[model samples]
Target: MTMNERIVQPQALLSLIALRDRALQAESLNALAFSMANDLYPVLHFHQALVFAQRGEALELLCVSGLSKPSEDSPYLVWLRRASRWVASQLPDQQPHWLARDAVEPPAEIAEGWAEWWPAGLWCVPLQRHDGQRLGLLLFLLEQPPAEGLQQALSGLWQTWAYCWAALTRQRRLRRWWPSRRQALLALAVAGALLLIPVRQTALAPAEIVSHQAQIISSPIDGVVERMQVRPNQPVEAGTPLFSLNETTLRSRAEVLSKEVAVADAELMAASQRAFDNPQSKGELTLLNGRALQRRAELAAVEAQLKRTQVLSPRAGVAVFSDPNDWLGKPVVTGERILLVADPAQPVMLIQLPVADAIALEPGAAVTLFLTAYPLQPLKGEILETSYQAKASDDGVVAYRLLASVEGKPEHARLGLHGTAKLYGERVLLGYYLLRRPLAALRAWTGW
Candidate 1:
């Protein structure tokens, strides 16, 4: 039948409408390509269909009839691509037309495979938008030439498919550039929920195990440290000798005073014996007695000071100090700290919280100590005291000194064990906990 006569058929009209609806309803370009290759058989009779989409200046195979997806390396596809490129180059107008092997000669390589892979007739359809942008090309391999009426029908269908392709392509581009409103809202809700999660505000600071009620062992007299009676961390009993000041000077002075007292006593005795015979000697007797008493007082003071040269631990505990060599031959003034006699069982955590990292810490706040020596076994503690003012710590950072009592005195707890302490403050939102430092830095930079 003629093209005009066939276009008037109700059944063909309904089929065209149905096909257009299917193209319009396609969710993606791949789905539309599949329908174009596989679903178009009812509208047009063909041995096979190949779909190609324009990527750049070249047409790439999107799908093929009778296959879920086309393999690019397949011999059939390889030859088809070359043939399609030659055909596409011939059609500058980007129009749809039928092709035959003899009508337009393809390259020898493409022509050589035409008889083996394709049918006698081929139809080329260029899928273009209303704005003249070429979307892709469609090819149909037919055993016999299509009727004039079929060509006219396909032209109308091409227009509908091209329009749908353009719409779907724009939709895809939009989807790529921006998420759908529903998806964006859902993501925002998830992020808000995550930000609202409650977490404990915490900070990490350098810490060490120290004696809670340690005895301060200081030099009792001004002298050079003669010796350390006990080693560092060594256990000592009450009244155990801890250290001693140099007693050589004090001892010599005591000896001199003792001799002076002896001399004064001999002089006084001689004067008392002489006083029995002469009145002048009686007057010297009082001066000799006074001199003897002064010597005795000086001797007693020297003896007392000599006894103080040796220091002893007043309580049973461990001696916490640096190397004995550090103190040996070291001159120390009176009341200078020598070493600590600490109760190892009552170990406390001493934290040096840097001023920059200091948070709102309160008494009884949580503290977790991970000692360098025993990191695997963490000890829990609570803040017992916090320094009212920030001072330069041993490492020279201005920090607030915090003292925390260990919850359970573990076996590894001992004086002078160094570690890192994690101190926790009031709970806050997870967002705040994560952004606290960053926000602080931002505020410092922007002053906002």
Candidate 2:
């Protein structure tokens, strides 16, 4: 007898007993399949083994012995794949296949490659449940076909292994995919309610404190600012001097007009006396009177202009200007803005909404502002007005201007104090509220 044949008699019986024990104790499908393949090594005289699992009407190679990943174009893989497909397509009445190199006719290229890499014969066993439902395929390589006695001994063992593998794999799949009935119902209920919930949509913009009703103080005539009577942000009463223009030129003209008025008065008196003494001089006196009146009117106009050179606050408020030096030496024209006399008690919000970040704004929309200086203390306000056209902001960005009135302004609130403002809009779904910007960006990208 051959040395291998003598050894297989006792080894085959021992391996069969070991396979039954290991299969019952295995925890996972991988462990069980790997153990079953290992236990059959001695009895089947196989060098390599592969396990494939059925997935959606096709077989997926799950585990391999002696390799990390198989190459797609390998000769042994190509032959094994064909054999697996043939077994998968078989009728229940057909038995499992034991293929030899000469029995199967494949492409010449595959045959040539296969001869160099693998043995001449292959054993393919179909894994199926007790009800005859196909699970997958088991593949092994051998030098030659097994003896009839050995095949008879392994036939029943193969059926038992298939049944165990199918049951373990199915149990694991069911546990992974199926949750408890209570958990499923709760998840569905939460999803339905979340889809129906409504939330307020908000847009953010930069804002600054501004006066609601501020009187703008400007120069009435063209002149250089000579002196400042009040400092920037200083409180002032009505008729208070904010800053005075260079009155040197205007005063000089007034002096000239005064001297001309005196000369006209003296001439007018002399002309009147002449009229009283002689009737011929009476016509001359009328002309002299006209000249005197014209000079007097010119003097009055000059005096009025002279008075306007001293700029004054029209109402009691705080002066708002950048710096005293900004206006002290600056030349101004008629009606050029110099400063703002704002009522400190009536500060409002001026928001600069960038064109890209702007949304639909309406009067009475709620707004919350968090100042950079005092981020923890938020100021509440409501939108009062919004500009239809965009204007250049102080920072050189094109933005829409919005006016808002504070609800309860603090005593420390001052004009030009900047903060971030959040404006609330119409209610919408929570999903829409969060995804509004992303959806807008997607639309812009797709141009739809």
Best candidate, lDDT-wise?
A: 1
TM accuracy, model 1: 0.56
Error of 1 at 207 (Å): 0.8
- Name the weakest run of 10 consecutive residues (lDDT summed) in model 2: 86-95
TM-score of every prediction relative to native: 0.56, 0.54
Q: 12-48 in candidate 2: lDDT tens per residue?
A: 5777777777777777777766775566776676867
Candidate 2: residue pairs that collide: none
> What digit string (tens of lDDT, one per residue) describes model 1 on residues 1-448?
7545766689878888888889989999899999899887876668999889999988888889989977778887877778878878877577777787777777788788887888887888898877788999988998656777777677778998899889988987777666789999999999999999998899999999988889898888899998888998899999999888888998899999989999999999998888888989988988889999999999999899989988889999989888999988999998898888888888899999998898899999999999999999999989999998999987889999999989865889877889999999998999998888899999999989
Which regions of candidate 2 are displaced past 4 Å?
A: 1-197, 273-281, 430-448
Model 2 error, position 446 (Å): 9.2
Clashes of each: 0, 0
* Model 1 spans > 4 angstroms off: 1-176, 179-197, 266-291, 430-448
Q: Positional deviation of 22 in candidate 2, in angstroms?
A: 21
